[model samples]
Target: MKLIETIPENFEVQIQKITGDNFLKEKLESLGLYKGIKIKIIKNNKVDPLLVKVDNRRVSISKGLGLKIFVELL
Candidate 1:
């Protein structure tokens, strides 16, 4: 149920686990990537970072960090 496993777009999930990239992890949390928060993968900018929606705000996540977060689709 990892976030990366979710489809390219159109999915909402709760963050279940986060691993690797310590600095990225902290940054994600600061941007509202807590366990209970729901997130939606808006799109993956192939040439750049992944864009996601958190608390009605858009946030860009690095590819490395995106690969480590496990999410349960809701």
Candidate 2:
């Protein structure tokens, strides 16, 4: 699995884990980010803050948080 932040833009991957404190986990879940789900890194490509597509929704996540979310490419 690779850290979400390091994954290049326009790539798709399946979420394997979300690691952090309980508060971070809860926050991610509330945003529809959990394990065994597909997500795509948007290609419009803004560094620092990243944009990820979760289901039909596009969520913006910080680099710090993205680094904690791991995924395996499909």
lDDT of 2 at 33: 90
Model 2, runs deviating above 4 Å: 43-46
For 1-74, candidate 1 gives per-residue lDDT tens digits of: 66554447767778888887678778888989877788888886556677889979998877766778888888
**What would you estimate as the lDDT of candidate 2?**
0.85
Model 2 per-residue lDDT at 63 = 70
- Give the clashing residue pairs of candidate 2, or none: none
Residue 51 CA displacement from its true place in model 2, Å: 0.5
Error (Å) of candidate 1 at residue 55 is 1.0
Whole-model lDDT values for every prediction = 0.77, 0.85
Q: TM per model?
A: 0.80, 0.89
Candidate 1 whole-model C-alpha lDDT, 0 to 1: 0.77
